[model samples]
Target: MKPHQQGTERVITSLDWLAVLPVGLLLRQVDLTGCGPTCITVSRWRPGAGAGGLEGTGLCVCKEDGAVCGSDGRSYRSVCALHLRSWVSLQSGGERIRKAHDGECKLAPVIVVSPKKIHNVTGAQVYLSCEVKAVPTPVITWRKVSESPKGVKLLEELPGDRVNMAVQVRGGPSKHEGTGWVLINPLMKEDEGVYQCHATNMAGEAHADGSITVTEQNKSKKASLLAWDNPS
Candidate 1:
């Protein structure tokens, strides 16, 4: 603030957009219309993010055109928090929505596997899993590095089965939306090849891979009668 400027101290708050919607909008009617130093509104990064952590975006109340109100988008009573929560509604005049459109915080579903280090035999069945850290449970699919595992003898598959989604994938619970399972059933010798886990959601697909080794069993016990015979 310049020496000449007075009453321009902005109000800061801890509430997120969702928590401050109903009353925060009212800040515009009184705060902006007042005849004091233009209220310079600002806030601490997401409450839970802690003292120094800042994950969400913010708004700046600039005194342009000799007034808190200006033609350049900044001239709003309220700014919808980065993602347009609520209190942000009145202070920034919906800046959050505009930002969301221009700069989305979408999380591309990423495939993460547990026990990333796995070893299997030709006749052993293997199990791999993945989850998208993004919102909206993504579609989970399986693939082979070499080729699709189609046309396999399902009945004779090692572990005697195929890896497939156990349940219809939908938006996982809010906290674990992009989560899913990848099951490899009746793993076989040819199936020893590497397998890829794919999870796709509206945002995008995330990828991860796991290597598989199929150790062949030793030859059967049958031996030829003439084997090791002394040559005349």
Candidate 2:
């Protein structure tokens, strides 16, 4: 500090820089009523490297090797970047990133499955399933395409008179494996359409299309006999 003729000048030495300033070390400039130049005050502060430099307030300097999993189901280069992005998201009034994990994220659900397209006769049985694996068990639902050319709707549980509900692997409580519904005896016309299996958890939702085609037994027999007789 240099004492001039008017007031005292405060100077922050480079070696005195600290990462954080203590509350007691904090100084404020306030005008004292009827106070002369002798009461003048000078406040100065300098942040160190650990404090993210002078303008590093609310900012982070991430390490190159740092990695973190964001609640938005994305892997970030560093925790600092993740927090910075989260703050940006909040400022924009969008969905906030709620959680973060170390060593990258491996919690989102994954669907390892295939679609089934079947052609069967009337009064035949069929099964539709969807396979999903995740840290948290997923919920499975079935939907059938409307015959009236409309969109699909949620397939509610049956009356349980014919065991029409879905079945799980070894009857486990979780519907993780290829668990799905059972059609006891589907009609040729009433049951021929597209069915869907949807699996959902905290991560996301996945869908698989199942196309069922039921044909009349008599129609195939008559066509086969006519083709055999004409040898065409």
Q: What digit string (tens of lDDT, one per residue) describes model 2 on residues 140-217?
A: 666665543465454533323434334443222353343545454545456677776677777677777778887887
Off by over 4 Å in 1: 1-106, 112-115, 147-176, 217-232
Q: What TM-score quantifies how close candidate 2 is to the native fold? A: 0.45
Error of 2 at 217 (Å): 1.5
Q: After superposition on all CA atoms, what RMSD does each candidate show versus the true structure?
A: 13.8, 17.0
Q: Which candidate is the best by lDDT?
A: 2
| TM-scores of all predicted structures | 0.42, 0.45
Model 2 global lDDT (CA atoms, 0 to 1) = 0.52
